[model samples]
Target: MSAADDRLAARVRALAAAVEAAEGRSDAAVSADARAVVERAGERVAFSGSYTVVALAGATGSGKSSLFNAVTGTELARVAVRRPTTAKPMAVSWGSELPHALLDWLDVTGRHLVPSGPHELSDLVLLDLPDHDSTEVSHRLTVDRLVELVDALIWVVDPQKYADAALHEGYLKRLAPYADVMMVVLNQADRLTPEELDRCLGDLRRLLDAEGLRATPIMAVSALRGTGIKELREALARTVANKQAMTRRLSADVTVAATALAADLGTANVPRVDERLQRQVVAGLGAAAGVPIAVDGVRRAWRKRGTVATGWPFVTWLARLRPDPLKRLRLDLTPGDHSPTEVNRTSLPKASAVQRARADQGLRELTDAATSGLPRGWASAVRNAAGDRRAVLLDRLDVAIAGTDLEVRRGTWWWGLFGVLQWLLIAAVVVGAVWLLANPLLLGLGLPQLPPVLWYGVPAGTWLLVGGVLAGLLLGVLGRALVEIGANAHARDARRSLEDAVRAVVTEEVFEPVEAELARYRLARQQVAEAART
Candidate 1:
């Protein structure tokens, strides 16, 4: 292979790799097309030896058989009188030995003897290929295969059928690039006058030129009258003798392969998800849940109230001044007569049925934008898959929030009251003790003269009793306040956690997978573009 050929191959391989990396799937059609091109290249490589294969191709009744006979100076190719008569190919070899490799490659088994006549052009192998305009598709395919493998082509045309639509549209337009190795013969020219032949040959040349075959050689010939046969033979012999025949064949094969490979570059439309849509989804969800509001409520409640360690009843009531986090989002958490459970967000903004529908529509719009212009079938498939995922996401969100304990626990409010009553009982005992000691009536019963014991002990005992009761009451107040604060904090934390969880479930598990599926759809668009090129 040449350096340029190597570079082209490397470029194709790199394209395959880049496509695979970006889209996570290999280009199957591209690889298949490349393989086919490489196969054609290999065939051309094998033809670089001593062989000159000439292909005779044209539409039915174009007189290719007549020209084939005139070029070889023999009636070898059956000059059928009927239209579309050549059912199989006929090979006429010039040299004593047949080019077995070329013949086998062409799959031409039918061979004939060229009688010892004009042996001047002894190196050329003339193959009378089947008509491309034959009714049988196999015959047309055979002609097409020969067109790719042959070293040179002779397009024999009758004046009447030279401009036939099938010959021009199907074959001439496609094979125009090989005109360097092609020659157009207006065969059976004796049937037409000089003016008619001139006009037809001129038009044929113009058509070939229009098909990208500038300076393509055109000759007028009559196989019956032996007109221009020697010139055609000389042209064929010169083409083989110069060793440019194989080069032309290789170039033709390259063109054929390139054309086939180009077909695979068609559009494969697949839709995807846009990042803007994703951001919108996240923002909408955050707004609907009122997460920021709930967070703010928790922060205010935390600052206004003290810790639960302080046992105070008044402090607990102070904690209630702030709003409940769940309540702020309108997620009702009033515990039922049964066990404690999560509050349902039936009345929450955007959580209502109509609001949910709108949110779903927003998500769908984002998904649609990501995968815009993708095929309806592929889009539907991805949408179905996303629908399944959204169900799972909603279920998971419900489960996370539902599992939180939102009900008031046991000993919540009564514990602080019990601490207050205990302090009061201690105060009563201290007062009774003081009164018993100071009373003159109680001392008359031979009680020892409590000298100054009442003065110091009674006051000290009274101060001790009041101080102990106040300390217990303050502790009770602070402790109860702390408990309410802690509970409030827990509720706020649980709400935030649930918000995040639900968002992630809807976006990652639900939205992101949908996005990936949409990406898959977008990547498929290459197939459509490829088809257009083909």
Candidate 2:
């Protein structure tokens, strides 16, 4: 392939990539049209650019077949007066090798090779296409298809129908973007006088200007009388020699395809997920996961466990009789050992309808916010991405919560100290009770009497008993207050830990997928923009 062909092929490939990226996310009609353009252009570019392919397109009875025969110097295409003569396309190749591959791609079976002649215009393949306005549907369809594939368009118009709306509005106006590869010819010019010819040519130029085809070349020719065939031949020779018609035509196709898809790529910036949306998602998931109830369980469990460790020895057993709050909820309140043990499921209730609705609403709001400036189809795609895995969302969140280590089992330094103090008090009470009982037993046995010792006007044995009882009760009260304070702080920390776990799940399951889609859109838009430039 030539450098020019490679460049054209690159542009076509880029367009094809963009269209594929947008296939399910854009308007079906627009994407289909773009895909067709890429396919047709690929087929056309595969053939060598040794010759130029020009088509003579016009309405029925516009003398196009006559001009085709005149150009080829033979009666190749059938010229008739029965309304529509050419039903299918006829091709005439001069001097250059036959482009069988190209003709096969064009589906043109009616082909002829011109006899050896002046090699000035040898590298030209002229096609006589079906009438654009034929009453037969197939003829018009064939014309429409060939017009897009040909390298250059030579519209053959007669003086009588030069101003026809079908010629100007249907073909010329729509083909304004391809003016570089387009030409207009007034055929059968022998019938008009010099003044009439000039006036007609001037009026045609004005009409072409109105159709945005001001740069298109115009010529006066008579295929039958051969008045201006030489000029037309010279023009064809110049175009074939340049060999840029194929490149120009392909470039124009890319531009048109890109324009059709412009609506889908309205803005360059991809939408982003805001902090508010992230917070809302976390809140909803937390609610669905019963985070509040779990935190409360942590608090209650800490208090009960702490009481067993530091409560007065007399009633510490009572505390063990009641069920552990965290255990009942099926949670391990113990600090994580970082082992590979299986995580326990929480007995929290399933999310109610109201909770589910709130979560769904938050997801919708996130989608809307992220896709605010995107096209409708792209916005819809993003919204669909957000909800694509919604059925599995709650299950995933529950797993995340269960895997979290709430650090509820972490013990405070004061807890151990209080435990030791409680044990010492129990020992003191035991020792003092033994002393009081032994004193009475010794007196009853009539042993030798001993002097009585007193503290603050009480006997020594009585002092020991009363002090132990009062001090142990006071220490128990202080330990209970400390346990309450520690439990409250622990609950707050557990709630934070659960929230962090829930946030991570939301990011993985929801935000990442949506961002990935936006990244795809960004890449597609970039490809389309580059293709358009080419």
Candidate 3:
């Protein structure tokens, strides 16, 4: 617990932050007991740094209380009476001052202080814990709490119960993370012959090793006959002298919690967003938004303008009477109105339920592909983010359509030119009809008639009238063909611009939120890894 503990402090903080980060997201992020472990570590470290709280835990017949008394060289644990566990834990402090705050935080109501003296175990605060195998629920609970909170454990077992399954499976195996500060004591070794003691110790060592505690220290001591009491005291003295047992125990608890969190965190490889997927989404939403209908309107609107400008001079006014197709859908943004008004919601037909369903399904497929290998919790989170703005999706779509400038403005210059030429041909036909009528009048009045100009031996008046009418009809046909081509190109431009607007809306409503959630997951994963590193 010196300069290097600074690193331990930082690691513990990271683990605490991770637990806090995952608090509301998922319950499986960490075990329920991990919070208590974190709280204990924080309070213990802030208190007396010199004191090492070592607990002696065992079953009812293990004689662990007597072993505790032997190590302390005092009758503090009441070896004759086993009913002492009916009370709280008994802590005998070996230092001059009482660690009232520390013991109170430990919930140890029973406290004792030995006179300050030059002893090797002065920095130790030894606890005689309740038997773990007690039938009473309170005693078992007491043992369970102290087992997790104590800085070190000296598990006292006898030759008869050294291979007990409850002790090995329920406690030892589960506590493999704390092996650095845990030890096994074979109490009452004097009752067994030397050969029997060797056999029992070897067997117990094998059991501990199989439980993933290969480095856990083992000592055989007969508490009643004082056989190995001196060696146990020397072991505790060395454990206390370093003043790092508490730090190690807290670090172990951090490991246990971090392991649980890391297990709950699934794979960290979030797939990159594919533009094709985005384009597919845009295409799907475009259908739902009636983009095809809008483009058709654009084509018709362009042709309508052309017809009013280039149709037969006699019929052009009738073409202008009909309403433009795009204006009917409220998608008609006039030229030079660069910033379309989103408030002018489109009159386009609302999407049917089937169309809405397809849009939703497409979005789901896209998200699933993006987070394919992620765990259920994170995937659910991302899905939640994607759907967060769903209630207003249609409303926002209306805004996007209304704000699109469809570029269906003035027709090509050929329409105006054709209209002027058709007007000139009509004038020629009128003049030729007047001249033909006047020729008869001149003859009846005995006046000279004008000479008739001829083309291909036909009367000039007849040719003027017939040729002008035919030429006007041919020019109208040619103008219609040109307008058809220009309308298609205009429709394409309109479709491209509308699709761009729809993509923006989809990105705002879906992609941005999902990516933010993915970013959040990455940060949490990095913190978890930092906490998990030993």
Compare the candidates by lDDT and give the number of the best one: 2
Pairs that collide in candidate 2 are none
Could you say which candidate leads in TM-score? 2
Q: Which stretches of candidate 3 lie over 4 Å from their true place?
A: 1-4, 13-44, 81-86, 115-119, 267-269, 333-343, 352-354, 409-478
Tell me the TM-score of each prediction against the true structure: 0.58, 0.91, 0.84
Worst 10 residues of 2 by lDDT: 333-342
Give me candidate 1's TM-score against the actual structure.
0.58
Candidate 2 — what's its lDDT? Answer: 0.85
Q: Tens-digit lDDT track for model 1 on 1-534? A: 555445444433433333342232224565454445446556755744666778888878888887787777777777766764677888888656676776777789987655455566666778898888888888988887777667788888888888888877887787777778888888888999889877888888788888887746888888889898888888887887776666555545444444443333234443445667666665555444444444454444333333322343434455556564445544434556225554443233335565466557766776566546544444555566566666555445554444444332323454445555544645654664574456465468766644443444565455555655576576665555665676577557756665666566666665766766655544433332232221
List the global CA lDDT of all models.
Answer: 0.62, 0.85, 0.81
Candidate 1 has an lDDT of 0.62
TM-score of 2: 0.91
